[model samples]
Target: MAQMTGKQYKESLKKVKPVIYYMGEKVDDITKHPAFIPHINAAALTYDMALAPEFEELCSAKSHLTGERINRFTHIHQNHDDLIKKVKMLRAIGQQTGSCFQRCVGFDGMNATYSVSYDIDKKFGTGYHERFKNFVKMIQTKDLMPSGAMTDPKGDRSLSPSQQKDPDMYVHVIEKRKDGIVVSGAKAHITGAVNSHGHLVMPTTAMREGDKDYAVCFYVPIDAPGVMHIFGRQSNDTRKCDCSMDQGNCEYGCVGGEALIVFDKVFVPNEYVFMCGEWEYAGELVERFATFHRQNYGGCKGGLADVLVGAVYSLALAQGTAKASHVREKLAEMIHLAETIYCCSIACSCQGFAQPAGSFQADPLMANVTKLNVTRNVYEIARLAHDITGGLLATMPSEFDLHDPTVGKWVDKYMKGSSSVPAETRMRLIRLIDAMTCGTALAESMHGAGSPQAQMIMIERRGSLERKKKLAEKLAKIGDQPVLIC
Candidate 1:
């Protein structure tokens, strides 16, 4: 089949029957559910954009496996250009959605697995690489959305998965059958979990020898028996059901529509199991995936920041403050921060090099640096936005009040920003700023790829401080002269 259109993607969901719960009730059809439709719409654009003439070069790629045209999300990073295009594609989608489109996780997972499996095969004489290649071909042909499921529900911070009071705290292989394995545990805060076609499950962290069972990795259909999802709630998510204007980014929603996916003794056939009992390579897979995923923040968040900066500027205009020096300065600061993020993403991509398995990955040090900057810069950008827009962003009345028949006249009269701009237009822009800057959106920016500390650890490991010190010593003539007796 050719790449799916947005409409086809929506229809495809109708055939999937994942066991999903939102609030307290079972969602019969996620495609039709109000809570999921916005996220679904956001993901669908990932497909639709690829078919558009202008975006085709960035959003679509020829599959290395079959030479067929496929969505870039399913294509492996075959070269440095492919890695760079991945960043560009993310930014474009982020600008279009102004929210998490939720496909990058799986894309990163595929690439990480592709390279790591080969190394594992070389050392252990395993056939994981060939099996994974087949899996990639299938995904490319079907153009399916697979949630990259990592991040286990760790019961305690100090304990390893093997030492945890409850062994099931992290996903582990409970029973290894002749045909395959049965995994039992849960993955928390999984993006697009409820809406995706299946999950590419992976270990959350590095593992020791005793943690072999927890190092398991595999793919399972969303509707696979014993797999169930409990949809997570965003700060203003319920507003999605009630009002349009109040919901902010009403059409696209926020933060990837995360969910808690439980695998209760879910059986998987051997064909879908990419890694099993491969404890030694767990850290390699984790690091590779983290670096690739980290490289994306600048692209996606920078694009989102672009929308936010524009909205703030529009708000200033509506209130007749566009020419104010302070507001203009704040706007300029926001643009600078956003562009700085884009530069980091591009730099990392351009510095990317090929792995042993012939897939390109972003430079590790730059990618970590890129994500660390995102953690701090995006917040400052949001702060400047709030300063320019004022407290009215949070204090605004509901959309219902704006449209209420009895008090509507009062709202229109008092809320008017300028004599020329309609009060309704100003209110709409306020709501957009409110949704983009607060609650779930802000938190996702801080910890989406990994926490600030996670990036710091990688930076410390890869920083090459000793080498840098030598350069400094040589420049200062300290290396040329023998060390003093002192």
Candidate 2:
């Protein structure tokens, strides 16, 4: 049980051969597919770092379960330190990739499942806790990249899973057999499905008595019999196929490689199923999973902000505006916003306490607040980056023009920002900025773990307004008496 190197990880994907479709055609080889290569490269960097001696401590951790040096992505958080390290690891990866490396969902999912399963066993006297430990042990031992398939395709926004006109709108158990249960329906916006070795499936929302069949949690291999993965497209994603210069962060592309994972009567054996029909705990499971996932935005996006801030500075220098007081001010603002997020993430992790399970959990209030800020701050960071970079971001000459035989010289001659720097350098940084801010990165920021409204709801629930009101009363000298108006 050793960690896979980047090359080993890439080779491993070649063997998966999940049934994936992109652009109306079956993706035969994702490793070489232009649409998927950037994503693969981005995820591989996670493995690449684990193998680097300099990054080994940050990227690799000794597994509490096996005592082997496992990629931090697979190791469960054991203490407050583990949680802090998780955020730092995410930021580090974000710094390198500048896009979604698409591994955190499973990491969060594993911890959530670990804690919730123990709670389930405590109440129902079930063996799901043991089952989950065995399940995750396999994941860590193999160092697998697993997607947490949580969001379901609710046919109507207003309808719940069981209330939908289409019963298959949300993934649910369709039948029960002696050997296993069969599930159907789909999970949407699944990050890295095509590249993942497996998926950790969980209920999308809280469930009631009527939604028993929908209240299920399990893990399934990506290539399972009836699973079909339809790859998603990003804004200007096609640019990767045609031009490298225009595809800013050309090596990593933009955002998570999301997909619609349709599970049509996929079978899950008893050993693989963690929760079958315990409807009451569905909400608890969802909350646990989301809290950890939300806590993650600070780290990943903060790292990405690092890259964006650097891009802004580089472009300003190339444009001879590096010393402009306003430009420097805006650059500092971007860093401030990004680091503020990191601070919240670290705070939540430091405040984390051990769950009933051995693993620790992030503070939900701070985690939600962190995500809430991320929804706004990412947009603001992008806005400041856009303002400083100028309109050339929107109207840059194509890489083709720069490489053309006749117009190449003319394009270079005119596109040059500062004589001290090359036109190509300016164009490259701007494209990177455009790719990150204008495309999937910002949208993912808004909606990755949950939408802005989702965080607001959690914040309102956890804000403890009553305590604030009591403090306000004490400040107003009301004491224990009720104040009345005439």
lDDT of 1 by residue, 1-486 (tens): 959999999998889888998999999888877789889999999999999999999999999889999999999999989988999999999999999999999999999999999999999999999999999999999999899988999999799999999988999999999999999999999998887889999999999999999998899988999999999988888789984788888889867899999999999999999899989999999999999999999999998999999999999999998999998999999999999989999999999998898889999999999999999999999999998888788888887888899998898887889799998898988888888989999999898888999999999999988777777786688757335321
Off by over 4 Å in 1: 476-486
**Poorly placed runs, candidate 2 (over 4 Å):** 479-486
* C-alpha RMSD between model 1 and the true structure: 2.3
Each candidate structure's TM-score, on Cα atoms with residue i matched to residue i, is: 0.98, 0.97
Tens digit of lDDT per residue, candidate 2, span 236-267?
98898884779987799888899999999899
69 Cα displacement, candidate 1 (Å): 0.6
Which pairs in model 1 have colliding backbones? Answer: none
